[model samples]
Target: MHLSHPTPLQNIMESKTCSRRGILLPFNSYSSHKKDAQHCIFCDTTFPLRNFKGKAVCPTCSQNILKLFLEREVR
Candidate 1:
């Protein structure tokens, strides 16, 4: 009996086609813009800002603010 391993070329091609999860898509539809990077108001972490919206806080803090608002509404 004989076993055959993939060649270096095959390995490279496979890596380019797939990620840690599954096959790579032709185009990344969810890709976000990288030009508007800014620091989060609350945590001060740098992240990409979205669209034309002016947000001082990052998404995490925004979600937290929403949660707080919902909690206050339920009370």
Candidate 2:
């Protein structure tokens, strides 16, 4: 007998919010946005994507914020 299961690629393809290259979607080929978020990461703060002077925020803080934001949406 043979059985079938959803492969990792299939699972991703089936997702509605599937993003690629950390961009909007479908265009981003790198798929760098496939990251997980943590709970209680952001206590009380609104994290902006890019800060003033067009410079990005601190890497550590940015990562934490991204995780928190994503986790919240997932729930």
Candidate 3:
């Protein structure tokens, strides 16, 4: 039997390295899961609960919650 030519995915998979997006997809998925599954990392009391663009405001405080989030997690 004859083999088919390699597809783009086959090329990526056969290579020793992953593309930038491929390398980061798991990180993005994890971030998305964390962003979706938990409350605002700032106040730690309000869940985003609705939006998937990955944004939400704390119900009790006006703050750049995403900034607070990354700061908290990096420690």
Best by lDDT: 1
lDDT by residue (tens digit), candidate 1, 1-75: 544988889899998898676666686344353455567665676764332246566667676876756877999
Error of 2 at 61 (Å): 5.4
Per-candidate TM equals: 0.29, 0.21, 0.22
Which tens-of-lDDT digit does each residue in 1-75 have in candidate 2? Answer: 554987788787778565544645446443454343222224423343335235445445566766766888999
* Tens-digit per-residue lDDT, 1-75, candidate 3: 655898788897877475454433334555666655656434556553434356544554344556666877999
Better of 2 and 3 by TM-score: 3
Deviation from native of the Cα of residue 26 in model 1, angstroms? 22
lDDT of 1 at 31: 39
What TM-score would candidate 2 get against the native? Answer: 0.21
State the displacement of the C-alpha of residue 55, model 1, in Å, after optimal TM-score superposition. 3.3
Q: Which residues of candidate 3, in runs, are more than 4 Å off?
A: 1-36, 47-54, 63-75
What global local distance difference test value does model 3 have? 0.56
Model 1 worst lDDT window (10 residues): 28-37
